[model samples]
Target: MRQFYVYILAKHRHGALYVGVTNDLIRRVHEHREGLAPGFTKRYGVKLLVYFEQHATAATAIQREKTMKRWPRAWKIRTIERTNPTWADLYEEICR
Candidate 1:
């Protein structure tokens, strides 16, 4: 089975947030952390992986990403806090 990820990255607690969808979660997050990814994420330094959801299909992942991007900031914060109250960099966990 294939996997898709809808993810949120942040600069820090209550900081700028970015929403994206990818087939390779670890590599994509690594790119963001290293500032290898261009545009808003690199510009704003939103490299902390605070939230993510997996889907079986790219279409669902893309839909989730779009929905998240449209969410109010508070809602986004709540969503992150729900899974990562400390806003830990989930990269290591996934890498393991």
Candidate 2:
């Protein structure tokens, strides 16, 4: 079975947030960092990976992503802080 990822990117600490789902987490995040994805991420400079969740399938990931997008900003912030209190950029970690 293939895995999928639901991820959140932010412009900076406590900045604009973006929620998305992808089969290639690394590649998708890289495109966002490079300003190549085009749209909300590029326009808002939301390239820092602060949160993510994995699922067994793309459908599950997409459903979770949609749900997260509907979450209040404060709720999202708390979610990120629970696992990543510093809100560190996870691109490097994911690369490894």
Candidate 3:
């Protein structure tokens, strides 16, 4: 089945937060980390993959991304830590 992802990346010290959706989570995160993907994420250096949710449908993932984007900072952090207590780089965990 095809999959989609809604992911959040952060700069060191929570300097900036970036929320995005993608079909290939690994590739997308790699792009941000490598500074290959241009725009806000690269500009702010939001490279740590803090959180992500997967869905069978792209529409579902998109909806989740929209919801996350609207969430307050406290709520967003709570959501992230619900799965990632240390706000660790989840790229390896999820990719594995």
Candidate 4:
């Protein structure tokens, strides 16, 4: 099955938040961090990989991304910390 990813990136350990969906989480996050990916993520400096969810289809991932994007800041942080207690640099963890 084709997989999709719903991911969130933050600036520092708790700076800014950005929600997005993609198949290549690592590359996409790298793009945001490097400023190669334009738009709000770049503008807000949301570059730390914080939270992510894998899906069986793009449609599901998109829906999840929207849901996450609409979430309040507190909820977003809670969601992220559920799986990532410290909201550490998940760039390496996601790849491994």
Candidate 5:
């Protein structure tokens, strides 16, 4: 089975947010955390995995990522808080 992911990364609780889609969530997030992505996420220090949703297709995941990027900051924060009230880093959780 193949999967794609729409994910949000944050600098910290209620802080700078970034939305993206990837076929490999673990590797992608790792790159962001390591400052290897070389863009907004690296420059803004938005490396904490705050929220994510899996999709069966890349099209759906990409669409979701695009939609999320357009969301207001408050809406993004609300969505994150709903799944991760503390905005905890989810990288470890996903790895295990």
Candidate 6:
């Protein structure tokens, strides 16, 4: 079965945030990290994958991403901190 992802990237703890959805989490995150994805995330240097959740379908993942993008900054931060209090770069973790 295929999977999709809703992910949040940050410049740093409590810094610029970006919400996105993709079927290839690893490749997408890598693109952002390398400044190859272009646009808001690259422009703002939001490369740290702070949070992500999987979904069974792209529609669900995209909807979740849109919902997260509309959330207030504080709510987004709280959501990230709930699972990632330290706001650690999750790229390495996910790669493993």
Which has the greatest lDDT?
A: 5
Worst 10 residues of 3 by lDDT: 10-19
Between candidates 4 and 5, the TM-score winner: 5
Model 3 misplacement above 4 A: none
Which residues of candidate 4, in runs, are more than 4 Å off?
A: none
Worst-scoring 10-residue span by lDDT in model 6: 61-70
How does model 2 fare in lDDT? Answer: 0.94
Q: How would you encode candidate 2's per-residue C-alpha lDDT over 8-31 as one tens digit per residue?
A: 999999999999999999999999
Local error of candidate 3 at residue 68 (angstroms) = 1.0
- Model 6 ranges off by over 4 Å: none
- Give the 10-residue window scoring lowest on summed lDDT in candidate 1: 86-95
Which 10 consecutive positions of candidate 5 have the poorest summed lDDT?
12-21
Tens-place lDDT per residue, model 1, 1-96, is 989999999999998999999999999999999899999999999998988899999998998899989999999999999989999988889999
Cα lDDT computed for each candidate against the true fold: 0.93, 0.94, 0.88, 0.87, 0.94, 0.94
What are the per-residue Cα lDDT tens digits for candidate 5 across 25-95?
99999999999999999889899999999999989998899899998999999999999999999999999
- Write down the worst ten-residue block by lDDT for model 2: 57-66
**Once model 1 is optimally superposed onto the true structure by TM-score, how far is the C-alpha of residue 2 displaced, in angstroms?**
1.0
Which is superior by TM-score, 3 or 5? 5
Candidate of highest TM-score: 5
Model with the higher lDDT, candidate 1 or 5: 5
Clashing residue pairs in candidate 1, if any? Answer: none
lDDT of 4 by residue, 12-95 (tens): 776788889999888898898899998998888788898888999888899888888888999998898899998898998877
